[model samples]
Target chain A: MKKINIKFWFVGLILVSFLSCSDNETETLFPDAPANRAAQRNAELLDLLLSQPNGFKGVYFTKNDEFGGFTYYLRFNADGTVDMTSDFDTETAVESSSYEVRLGTTTELVFTTRNHIQKVSDPSYQPLIGTGFKGTSVFQYFTNDNGTITLRDIRNRDSGTLVLTPANFSNFETESVASVETSLANRDAFINSTAVTAFPFLSVEAGGNLTEFALNYDGVRLFANPTKFNDDGSIADEEFGIAFTEDGLIISPALDVDGVLINEFTFDGSSGFEYVATKEGVTAKIGYGNAPVTPLDAYAFGVRATAGVFNMDERFKSSTAFNNFYDAFAEFLLNTYSVVVGNVVFWDLNNGGQPYIEFITNAGRFWWDLDFEVTNGIVVFTPTGNTNASAGVTAIFQPLLDAFIGAPSGYYLLNTGTYLNFSNRTYSMINVDDPTMTINYWDFSY
Target chain B: MKKYTYIVFAFMILAFAMACDDGSDAVGESQIDTTPPILNDLDVWLRGNFVSPYNIEILYKWDINDTDIDRFLHPPFESSVRPVAEALQKAWIEPYTQVGGENFIKKIAPRQFTLVGSFNFNPNSPTITLGLAEAGTKITLFNIDFLDFTNINDIKRPLKTVHHEYGHILNQNIPFDVTYGEINPADYTAQWFNRSDAEARELGYITAYGSSQAGEDFVEMVSEMLTNSKEDFDAIVESISDEESKGIIRQKEAMVVDYYKTNFGIDLYELQALTEAATQELVN
Candidate 1:
């Protein structure tokens, strides 16, 4: 299926080209072979090529003995120029370049293009890589039985076969219907539209620094999310309209900033897309994508808090006042949510080891429930507490411990085994209760 | 009416002759490939940057029939090409032009460079070829696919090839002294690959392949002297155990140094230092 698709891609919108279409040997093409006409042999062949019907498509087929199969499309203009498009074959058919046609035993036309490399299948072809460096394909065209033109590509002993005939794609009319204001009301129908595609957006700054963004299109709209560095470029909120021109689908209208057009979403349904943005003579190419990417997930915050302490500030000047504040805060936290404090969330009951790890983030997984010493590390529970008491609330906080034993964070013995990559990350926020006492809280990504 | 009847009769016969005559059915002259050569940005880079200045054309497109088609090969990615080009301009071309004077390389340099991405593995032997200098006009370089312009060693591989091939080209332009090769004539062999670099060094040869032929040895000495640090060459000479073999290598080095001064009005040591600095700029 992939092979067939690639071939269809190469033999793009075929147009038939032929020298003569005759079923018999005794055929006269020039209705009136005028006596005044000179022997304009090559000119006559050119006339035959140019006089084809308006929608006549010409296709060149080459079965390269070394480099597999390939095709090129040639459509001649009345003004002596040939427009060509190609599927990359043994030789690339230079687009919008003039091709040569001449009269001999068979007609000869040479196709030329840059940005092409000849790939071959024969083992013998490997040794001469640096020797032959011709960037053109010289083909000799012959009229075969039944009027089909067979062209033999005589470049580099490649012996590639080129067949030219009248060609048409049955669905050209349907494919040409690029845009209709369908104004899709829902996601499913819009996403399933044949035109919708994920285009990898390449953004070039005003000075020429390039970055990539995956512009994913659902049925109704195309979206570019906030990247790790820049949050303002969320295309869902920013993109204003979709207008599909003959060139392609322009999802966002061109926006001008400081006299330079910057954020405009436009893509032709090809392997790549380019549009002028931010710079007049410079257009950035956003690569076309066939695969949808996984969206970045936002981190969820749990009702967790950690209170920072100082030795003796003026606000917490009295020991009795500090005790009262601590009791109230600890009670509020424990009742409301799962809170583990003092850096270490869990200490193994048997080994008493703290789980400290660098952010490789792929910590091991577990589902076993075991005793964990969770803490708020507050000395609030002491009766009129001694000023120099060793500690209070050092034992397991059963409620917090029970809530997360089988969960991801509780299961991983940090610094052991493989690690899990993150789902999301959140910034750490600190809430000040008073000047001296602040609660710093954060949620984990993994 | 009698004169008009004769004119009409003559026109009819001519029309009939034109319509019926189909001998040979030849239409026009022999076909000439009339299409103009295609020039992309890479071609422009080679022309405006290198060829326009130095009269050289760099062929990076993988021409398979021109390549060793028996081996699996690919061209350097389009993005990967410019770095090597820029590096060549910096390390080899610019430095030579700087040292030998601007018009020096412009007057005598290889006109074409064929870049092959994969190393041209010798099918007959274990040793891989870095490049080939064709009749002093063209140079073919292998291992372009793996050229990291940022890596000194990677840059050195091709830089070395260019200098080595340039040596051959220079020799072809004004042949090198034959007496330089006579110093180590008995050590030369076709089995240059059989020995290791270290073994060849012990045998008073700079590289294993340098021992293959005298012409190669002289150029190898030229390329090695220009690419490697002076200390590195001195270290190699110092490592060799045999006194007579060492003396022969010293003689050959002196001859190469003298050939540069006498023929090209260049100091080989100065060119080596310039190339070394250019290579360091890439990494640093």
Candidate 2:
């Protein structure tokens, strides 16, 4: 989750002595067992107030009149941080710091969220720190009452009577769409993973009736909000909302030009994503992140120095060549992935918050010592525990984990015939013959 | 046999003589094929596990034998069947057997249990019947698919439903004190779900569902006492600000205890503790 950023240096000086409340730093300890039955009931109430409700876990809800009357949700994960999502849009305002759940009074449950903002439009930015929250929010639970629970925004006076419903079996412990924050996060990861942000214009196939035009088009800015750039000069704009799928990338509906959205941009990997507005006779291949060094400079997919395909404008060869070098290369990469497991360059580990990978296998459900790495656009599991013949399995699946860990972007690791992990967090095997299969994923690191 | 034949022939002749009738009546036909739907292994398990011990039958498969044919309902998921059965065993059946003896339940328990996956909702009246005990013989429970066996709250509510329905069954068999209904009879309304719990409690009812009627109120009071600890029940009674409402709740609590003791030879408080401990295993 990202954090909110405002002009906080000056604001901090002004309110340095403001946040000195005794309840600010609450204990994170689980309560001890109750002595009697009545105490047991009290302890149960406290437990619900404290722990992540089992099965659709780490999902929290809040309502505020900050933007009129709207209800937003927070995805409080295993990291103890909260991701506050917008009700009107997919924009998520994440907590600047971690949140804590503490007993406000004998009866009330208080959850505090510090200010931070990670625009749902942009998933790449490191959240900026904010001044503070507007005011404290209060949550209370009542049984056999009007509703199961409620949250009141003390600042805005918007009261939300919450209904946390239990989902069915397969959805157990999975991210919920009803909890908007996690849904957006999950959606963003999927979209960005499919290289949505990578494609700016993609490909334009023009055939109806075309005329020659000069290629002086540098000042044409497409997406809004200049956010940041990686060390390799990759741009991260805060206003680019995307939806990625197995087929192609889906841009926000608002990006449509005259009711023609470049909805399906299939990045064939050799060239850039090829997009065409239907009936427009305009097909163009797009590239990722920032615009080219020069407006007319050719943008190619990993092959800029050699002979490449020309970026066409009207009936003219306007910009750089997009080489067909990766077309056969992408297919070749998919075929020998099992062999490429040991050939990985590096494992980019998710360092903070101890995000676990549940390896539910014949090796006997290892969860304690776990880590994840994203390399070549695929997620992989790396557990410290040795899992092999001792726990009762013939062949070790460490190579498979290596393959999954090294699976590049837009590819996932499954046994011989498994479908795409639709939620994407979970990975499983299709072959019953394989000894170890099915790994449940909980990604605390963005 | 000869005398009967002679009488029959004389009667037939007399009837033929008296008949000035045209043949218009047609006999009602029947679809007479009698291959019963093959009951599966769940039935075999139920017979071995429940029926042989207590003469109880468990039905989880779709059966139109005695159901409302037009109502939309489905069977529990195959995976949920055993977990639900185990939870039923742990929470309801075993506790009763321990407290009231094996013979006690064998003599008085419902003979059949029907499980459904979804709630039986009535569109005309906004009420969903979670459990129904029919004539002290069968108890039907809905939403078994949603029950998470590891969680106490999930198991407790169904057990509460079982206990409440069984209370009704017991009432039907031996009946409660008539004065139990005569305590506070004015606020009983069929539209009980419309009112809030606070409003219901203020009006001298334990829950909104209890305010449905005197009969439901009695069972609800009994179920609450059996399922909840003394402290929890005391909190509810104490939370009611009105003194008269408090007094009424106390009276209902006393009558429930008396009903359990005088009829079943069971101490209500001890039963509550036992039930609480059994359920605590599911959660803790």
Q: Using TM-score as the measure, which candidate wins?
A: 1
TM-score of each: 0.42, 0.37
Candidate 1 lDDT tens digits, A17-88? 111222247777675453312225445545555654321223222232222222334555554445543333
A23-84, model 2: which lDDT tens digit per residue? 36578455542234334444455554334433212212122111112223344444444444
Model 2: per-residue Cα lDDT at residue B134:
94
Per-residue lDDT over B25-128 for candidate 2, one digit per residue giving the tens place of the 0 to 100 score: 44544323242533456557777888898888877654434344444344455556666666667767777788888787798989988886655555466576
Could you tell me the interface RMSD of model 2? 32.4
lDDT of 1 at A182: 22
Tens digits of lDDT, candidate 1, B1-284: 64765576467556555545566577755444355655667667778988788888887754544455454444544555677787788878887787789898888988888776555656656667778888888888876766776678888888888888999999998888787777767878898788997788777788887898888888889888877888877878888888877887888899899999999889888888888888888873
Interface RMSD after interface superposition, each candidate: 12.7, 32.4
